[model samples]
Target chain A: MAGERVQPATLSRSEAALVASEGKAPRTERGRKTLRAILDAAAIEFGEKGFHEGSISGITRRAGVALGSFYTYFDSKDAVFRALVRDMSDQVRDHVAPAIRAAPDQIAAERAGLSEFIAFVRGHKEIYRIIDEAEFVDPESFRLHYATTADRIAARLKAGAARGEIRADISDVHAWAIMGMNVFLGLRYGVWQDDVSPEAVADSIAEMLARGIGTK
Target chain B: MAGERVQPATLSRSEAALVASEGKAPRTERGRKTLRAILDAAAIEFGEKGFHEGSISGITRRAGVALGSFYTYFDSKDAVFRALVRDMSDQVRDHVAPAIRAAPDQIAAERAGLSEFIAFVRGHKEIYRIIDEAEFVDPESFRLHYATTADRIAARLKAGAARGEIRADISDVHAWAIMGMNVFLGLRYGVWQDDVSPEAVADSIAEMLARGIGTK
Candidate 1:
């Protein structure tokens, strides 16, 4: 529900590599492309119709994957879902982190981060709906989604505090508060409407944080 | 499901009175109690099962009223939902306004308002689940809720501006933002979990607004 795919599993890169290698060999690059297609179709189907309503046959039809090959890649529908969430979470983290690194200062970092986050959400709106529904399918995914991003932001805030840039006394609780607010607001305003651009909403939120409600 | 009671209608007071009065003798206090019991039962059933899962039979059973008597107060389940939302909205407003009025200063009024709002939600947590779920059942009810609360806070902000307590240029949009943030945060931290006291959460928010997030 935090706008991207998430997993509770803390698989290391090596473990992920081993799992990828162990998966049934789809002999050609074309076969690999088909796997990606299946994941994408599954995400849309699950998100729109929900877990209970989305059918494996419908998903295979949408992806143009052979029904037999679905078993080759995943143990079951749940496995496909777990894989999709992890992939999406990785994609989101990769998409947003570099933008933060590119900015020269705290304020600029926040601006870049917000803009990139908004752009990411706009670009992958469908996957977000799936992620939002993850709470019902597997609550741990939702909890991990918040925890991953909250931990990231909390780490940064802690670093800033150590450097004397942020208030020393501010708790990780407040960091989570900011993270939680931005997330829920993005879900409500970004995913659900076209009236306001995500970029504009992101800017407004960045402004609220960098300054706040009080007059400067 | 927000784990609270919510319904999908926005009935004005006169409309509610008209609906409640339908098919009931005016002198019958028993009728009034039966009507309230039906509404309360509806709230519980909706909260537990959501709009799609809740049935009129279940509601009447919970209310301990004859199944036929259900139609005496409401035309359908939807009507009952409308009445429930309207009733809760009025109850929340009634609970908050007097406390605000009795406070000694604007800050006190604000604090009182937040406390009363929290207390109201705590008191009616079950009913709140029904209202929150109504967001999906009917967007109009949610929209009416946002607009009503925004207008109230906007008026208060205007008063604060006139008294030179707040920045004059602050818009109703900001009022909406504050109202949205406070209410949602309360829902997340208060009703969702009791990890923090509602008063502390309100104080943190109130303090943030008053002093801003910058170095003092």
Candidate 2:
């Protein structure tokens, strides 16, 4: 999946800083790879043990990097956890963006986005734990995660409206309604159980979005 | 709200047992009142300090009840926390039941439920904290809270479908999707900020439910 996407030719100065701790970005490709590895490991560690119980050493060990190498990218356990939240958020966005963009219409785009989201959640079940845990461990990131995602949804919705693909009265409320539906559906069908396929879930929601539950 | 609703003629044996710790249920009206006070205090204490930092003494002091009174209702901090989760779950149901029952149709009932829910959240802002903390402090209660709530929603949606008030295809997915929408809407519009009124939020959703965002 990662291979299918376009890779950056070179990291911008800020992008490099983002890969490192305390505003230090990786200067080389190898450095970026190490940063990515540490984050993946942190996801597993934090997702399993939670924030207080998860440690820098555990992440480094899982990443197969030395303790010194861990600090080279992150200042502390908190920094790494913060970075991981953002990384996961970006991962979801990147993973779902293409499917959404490729959809013929807004409703199809939403259906595609939800299908991809559930698929992502099934593969990375820990994403729910880590993101949910953020509410207690890091409140700011928790707020940012939802707020940013909701904003993105709202933007897509408005764009859809402008193109006459959907109703013109689209607002933040619709965005939030759609987002909440997706989040809980992901929790129920993705994290909790897998009896239903993602395609079916998305299809049901898309049908509802196209029509509605009203009898009239 | 409680006054407007029908009260139980008298607490049944099992109902009495529910108000007290373990097998103890308050036998007298005074005992029931005391139990209510303790639970209310626990909400405040747990809401402010969270489960770990919250203490029995804090709850007692807030309730203005003796230490023995606290012991009479709950054996430990954990017990009270668990009870509080159930209590709040019941509280939300009781508070919203009247409005929902009064609505003209299924769609109107949902709108009313969401409106009343946001209003309730605004007044009892601590609800979000307490219930959310239950996710970590007592996983069982946390799951029960959502599961029970979702079940109630599913039942209501099914009832609406039976009455031909909603589409015949109403299923658990629709129920979960509606519940998710209400929850996040409550979190954003209810708890986070009150810039928008609950009525407006409900109005927007009700409109979407009646038609949907599709241009067709």
Candidate 3:
């Protein structure tokens, strides 16, 4: 998941938000903070109220920034929402990258990635609503989120195969399968309820991937 | 998914539609046919036009039924949409049940289910749009759709494990992982495009579930 993780290497919050924003990137530390604040606020706004009911004023107020400062980073509500989606997408990739990179094998890396992703969802419960809403709010962003995620997963699977860590015949099918598993698993265990620990869910799935569910 | 497939057994289209509709099931054969026509038209109306843009009158127009006939089955637009979601959910399960029941083992059953589901989606691309829009139009129906699907999957998995076809440690985690895999795989191979055959996608996933993705 890490080797093919979307976005450039070593991206900051400001940089990620900038990817979705139409405006120029902030120059100073304070400017970066404001942009970060706005993105986070947008996540909460859209997450709680959804895209249509969610307002730009609500985001600015939540960020504790003036409306003008909001405009400085994002041109309009749509711009900020798009930027927020990109920001959240990068946040997940970044959040799970280290654990994935540290894993001993491709299978272990995926386990680490899924475990980390679920844990991330538990903390940012709004992620599902935000990304799901983008399907109707910003169709392109929605596709880009899944498309890039799958691309990264496919990249790592290819790399894993190259290293003889996984099966040699990896393709988009497997990547999408894993991606969907992570998304829905996160929704069920992380957001909907936490009755099951992230490690438990990941461990079960990891076992399936390692030896499969079929009788030996 | 057959052994534990939700809804009553041997459900007709009218019965399936009745599960969602607040009104009573059509009493006569002619009434049932009218109800079926309304539901089919709703699919086309909501599928092509979406829930909000979709109108009750539009549905009646498409079905070639009178407005009174539409009101006879559903009270409001919301009712029809909710009914549509349930109908679609039942449709998918029923569509795939025969192949699943015929499979020799759990893995084969899942493969058969996915293969059939993709084939189903290819013909009913509007499924994603309608079911997804349910999240906003009717949150309960949206939750019910997925929750029930996952439950049915969990049931089949448990039975599969009992028969020594799959791993004994099957739980919600495994069920969700498989359900998620099928959903996304269907979206990619079924709705997004058909360059890859449903059988090929199912075969690849079946191989993964059978032998695992990690190098032996």
Evaluate residue B26 in candidate 1 and report its C-alpha lDDT on the 0 to 100 scale: 24
For candidate 3, list the clashing residue pairs, or say none. none
Q: What fraction of the correct interface contacts does each predicted structure contain?
A: 0.08, 0.66, 0.76
Q: What docking tier does model 2 reach?
A: medium
Q: Model 1's CAPRI class?
A: incorrect
> A58 in model 2: Cα distance from truth in Å?
1.4
Task: Score each candidate by Cα lDDT.
Answer: 0.63, 0.82, 0.82
Model 3 Cα lDDT, one tens digit per residue, B103-167: 98888898999999998888788888888888888989888988999999999988887887767
Order of quality (lDDT): 2, 3, 1
The digit string of per-residue lDDT tens for model 2 on A1-216 reads 222224422334565576467755777788877887788888889878888889999999998999998888888888888888888888889889999999988899999999999988887888887887788778899999999999999999888888877788788998989999999999888888899999999988898887642221
The digit string of per-residue lDDT tens for model 3 on A1-216 reads 111223323346558446535546777767777777777777888888888899989988988999988878777888888888888898999889999999988888999999999988888888888888887779899989999999999999889888877777789999999999999999899888999999999988888876642222
Choose the strongest candidate by DockQ. Answer: 3
DockQ for candidate 1? 0.22
For residues B19-109, could you state the per-residue lDDT of candidate 1 as single tens digits? 4635542235556667767877777888677677899999999889998888777778777776677666676777789988897655556
Q: Tens digits of per-residue lDDT for model 2 on B28-143? A: 88888788778878888888888889999999999899999988878889999998888888888987899999998888889999999999888788888888888778978988
TM-score of candidate 3 versus the correct structure, residues matched by position: 0.91
Candidate 3 runs further than 4 Å off: A1-17, A212-216, B1-17, B212-216
